[model samples]
Target: MTDTLLKTPLYQAHVDAGAKMVPFAGYDMPVQYGLGVKKEHLHTRDNAGLFDVSHMGQLRLKGANAAAALEALVPVDIIDLPAGQQRYAFFTNEQGGIMDDLMVANLGDHLFVVVNAACKEQDITHLQANLPEDVTLEVITDRALLALQGPKASSVLSRLAPQVADMVFMQVDNVSLMGVDCIVSRSGYTGEDGYEISVPQDKALELANALTAEDEVEWIGLGARDSLRLECGLCLYGHDLDTETTPVESSLLWGISKVRRQDGARPGGFPGADIIFEQIATKAISKKRVGLIGQTKAPVREGAKLFDADNNEIGVVTSGTAGPNAGKPVSMGYVKPEFAALESEVFAEVRGKMLAMTVSKMPFVPQRYYRG
Candidate 1:
C-alpha cells in the first residue's frame, strides 16, 4: 500500500500546486500537474521546468583517503576529477554487473555524490560497508534538490544566482541563491541546459518559490521526467540496468575512464574490471542495448518481446514511450549484436502481432547541454 510511502520536503508545496501525486520510489511524488505530460515534456524542452527531486539520496564522503577509497568502488577516474567538476559513474558488483549509476563531484575537502532514489539505502550501506574506517559517510537528509531544465534555464537561474552564468556543463560549486547557500550543479538528466540546486530543507520552499515565480519556470512532474530521460536515451536504474547486466551490455562503456580501462595506468582494480575489460577488448557479449522506432502509431510498451525476421525471440523491451518531441514512438531495448546495428530491421511483438521497427540511434531528440 502507498499509505506508508514517505514524503519529500516539498510534499505540501506539490499539493498546493495541484499536482497529481502518486507513489514512486517509496515517496509520494507528482506525476503531473494540470498541464499534462506532453505539454510538461515540451515545456521542459522549450522553457525551464522546476522539478522536486528531494527524494534522491545526497551524500558527502570525507577524509584524506576518501578519493582513493571511492576509486576502489567505482571505475571512474575520481582521483583525477578536478574540483568543481562532476563525473558520471556507476557501482559494479564482483561479476561486472551494475549495482547503480550515479554522479560524483569533487568539492575539494570532500566528494559529493548522488545516487538513484530507489537504490539509496542499499548504496549507502554498500559504500559504508566497503570503505575503510578512515573514510566517513555523511548523509544530507536536511537538504532538498531542485532541477531547472531547458533552453531558457540558464537565463532564469542567472537572475537569482549570476555567478552560475559562468558555470559550464558538469561543473558544480556552492553558490548563493537569494542569500541561501546552495550547491548548484550545471547538469541534469533531461539532456538540456540546466542546473540541479541543493538547498537546506528549511530554505527549500523559498528557493522553489523564487525560481518558479519566474515566467520561464514552471513545476514539472515525474511522468514528464521519465519520458524526457527516455527521449535522451538515459537509462532508468531498475529497467535499462540491473544486477545481472554489465556496463558493456547496457551501452554504458562510454562512462568508463580511459585511465581505468587501459594498461600502464591505475587500471582494473574495481570489481568485475576483469570481465568488463575483457568484454571491451573481445566484444564477446551476446546481446547489446539499442534504440528502436515504431513504424506504426502504436507505442511500444516495456516487456514486449523482440524478434528477428524468422520470429526467433531475440530480446525484451526495457523502456518505451511516445516521444512528444520526436513525433514518433521511441524506445530502448537489448538485442543480439547482429541486430544491434543502426538501421537494422527488427520486429517487436506488441499485443500478439509483430510490428516492424528499425534499430535507430538514440537521443531521439538532440541534446542542448551548455558545455563550455
Candidate 2:
C-alpha cells in the first residue's frame, strides 16, 4: 500500500506546518492547513495564496526532431509555438479521446511539459515508446511547483522578482527570486492572475517560506485549489475529463489550431483523429460539457444523474460542487446538446431528490486573468 502513496519534497514541511494531509493523486498532500477548506478558498480569492503543486509532473523532451515528434502525439501545432510561449494541450488516444490534459512549452531547443499528477507516470511511459530514439525524455522529479494566485499575486511576487509583473498570460521566463533561479509562468488552473513557479526541489521550502512572509500571502491547500478552479470553470482531469471523453465533446475545440484543422488536411496523427476529424466535419457530437446552477442548497456531486422536467434521463454529472465563490451550487457536466442551452431546465438527482437547475454559462465567477 505504501507504493500507492507518493510524496512531494514538501511532505515534511506539510506535516511540520500542521496541514491536514490526505491521499490525492497517489500522493499524501495537504488538503487544507489549519484554516480548513472554506477559509483557504476565500483567502486565495481575496489575497495571494501559495500552493505546493510539486506532485505535478515536469518533463523536458530534447532532440532535433522534438517538435515534429511531439506533433505526432498531440493535436496542438507545436511547431508554430515560438520560444518563451506555452499552450495547453492534451495527450490523445488513436480514437481522439483525451488521455490527459497537459501544458507544453517550446523552449527553443526542446519541449517543457507539465502533466497532471495522476497521469505523470503513464504519460512518461507513453512518450518514451512513441518518440524517436534520438529524442530524450528527462523527468524533472527533483523540482517543485508553486502557484501564487490572486489579484495581489503579481504585486507579492514583484517584490522579490520584479520582472514577473510584466509577463503576459501564457508567457514563460526564467528569472531569479530571492537568489533562487526559477521558471515563472503567468498561468494557473484557477481563472485568476497568478504565477506557477518551477524551482529546484531542495530550494522549494525556502521559496515557499519567503513568499508566505508577506502580509498578503498565505499557504493554501488542495481543498481551496479545487474550489477555485471550479469557480473558474476549469476542468479537473479525472473528474471533468477522462479517456472516454473527446476534446470536441468536452468543448475544447479551441485547443485544435486552425492550421491543423484546415490547411494540414490532418492536424495530428495522435489517437482518435479519424473520429475527431469526422466530428469536426459532420458535427456528430451529440453532447456538450456545460455549467449548471442548482436552485437548492444540496451540492450535486459526481455520478449524479441528469434528467428533463419529464424525468427522462439525459446524461450523468461529471463534476459538481456548492461553489464557494457563487455562494450557491454550481456544477459542470455533459448533457445532450439538444438540452444544453443556457436556460434549459434540468434536474440533478441529489440524494434521491430531483433538484431544479438551469444550464448556465460557465466561469460561474468572472475570470480575473491579467491578459495584458
Candidate 3:
C-alpha cells in the first residue's frame, strides 16, 4: 500500500486477520483473507460472512423538502418513499444515461444516502449543485459501514439486537448493538438475508470483532464480495453501468418507480425524463442488458465481445464470474435487442475461441432476502 491510499476503520482488523490488501476506489481494501475467495464465497452462501464496506460514501439530506428536492435528480419516486424504507436509485444525465447508482433511505427526519465509493466526490458535487438551498447535504465521514450477509445473518445479528429481527428487507432503523448506537438496515449487495450496520468510526472495529466472533460469521473480502454481487445479478457502477448507458439499456427499468413514468401522477420532472419516456413509449432501445450462462466450463469474462450465430459482433460482457453456488460460469452483458431475449444463443470470444453462452434470466442463485 502507498501513502496516498486511504484505510477504513477496520484496516488493522483486516491486517491482523491475514487479509491480502489491495487498492480499490483509492482505499487500501482486503481482496481476500486466510480462507481465500472461493471458500469465503461458499461460506457466505452456506452460513454467514461479514464484510467491511466503510469505504463507500454516506450522506444525510435534511429538510422538509429533502425528498422532493431529491426526486428531481433521479427517476425514482422519492416523494412517496415511506419512512424507515430504502430504495435503489441512480443519478441520470440529460441524455438519460446513468451516472451512478445509490441507495436512498427515508429516515423520518432526514434522508440517509449511500453512494458508490468511486463516485463519492462526483455524486456529492451533483447533489450540491442541483439540490435547492433548503435541502442540507451533510457528508458522513465519521462512520464505518459493515455488511453481515448469509442464511444465518439474521440469527447472528438478532442475537446482538433482538429488535432487528422484525425488520424486513429494505427496512431501516436506528438501533443499539452492544451498547453502540448504529444505523441498521435490512439490506445488502449479496442476494441473501443480511443487515448493513453503520457504526461510529471509533466503535467499528469492536462491532466487526463481535460479529466475526460468531460461529456462523467470518470476515469476507472484496474478491468474494464481487463474486457474490455478480452472482446476484447486481450492477457494479462503473462496470455494468456507466454514464453512457441509460437505465433502460441496463435492464434497470424496474428501478424507476411507476409514479415517475410518463403516465403516472407526477411525471417527466426529472432529468432525461423525456428521453426515458420516449424510450419506454417507443421501445426503440437498440441494445439491452442480458444474463449469459456458459454452456462449457470455461469462464466468460468481462469485455469479451459477444457475437450472434452469423458471427456478427452483438455486444460486450460487462460483468462475469464463476458462480460458486450456481455451479456454473455466469455473466451479464449488453446485446442487440434481437439477441437479448431469453434462451437466445450467443457466443463470447475468449482466448480466440468462441464460447457458447445462452441469454438467461438473472439472479443465477435465488435471492434469499427476508420479506417477512
Model 2: lowest-lDDT 10 consecutive positions: 259-268
Each prediction's whole-model lDDT (CA): 0.93, 0.88, 0.94
Judged by lDDT against the true structure, how good is candidate 3? 0.94
Off by over 4 Å in 1: none
- Model 3 per-residue lDDT at 123: 97
Collision count for each candidate, in order: 0, 6, 0
Write model 1 residue lDDT over 53-152, tens digit each, in one string. 9999999999999989999998899998999999999999999999999999999999999999999999999998999999999999999999999999
lDDT of 2 by residue, 280-317 (tens): 78878878899999888888888999999999999888
TM-score of 3: 0.99
Residues 1-372, model 3: lDDT tens digits: 458999999999999999999999999999999999999999999999999999999999999999999999999999999999999999999999999999999989999999999999999999999999999999999999999999999999999999999999999999999999999999999999999999999999988989899999999999999999999999999999998988889999999988888888888788888998888878899889999999999989899999999899999999889989889999999999989889999999999999999999999999999999
Which stretches of candidate 3 lie above 4 Å from their native place? none
**What's the C-alpha lDDT at position 142 in model 1?**
94
Q: Quick one: best lDDT, which candidate?
A: 3
The TM-scores of all predictions, comma-separated, are 0.98, 0.96, 0.99
Task: Please state every model's RMSD to the true fold in angstroms.
Answer: 0.9, 1.5, 0.8
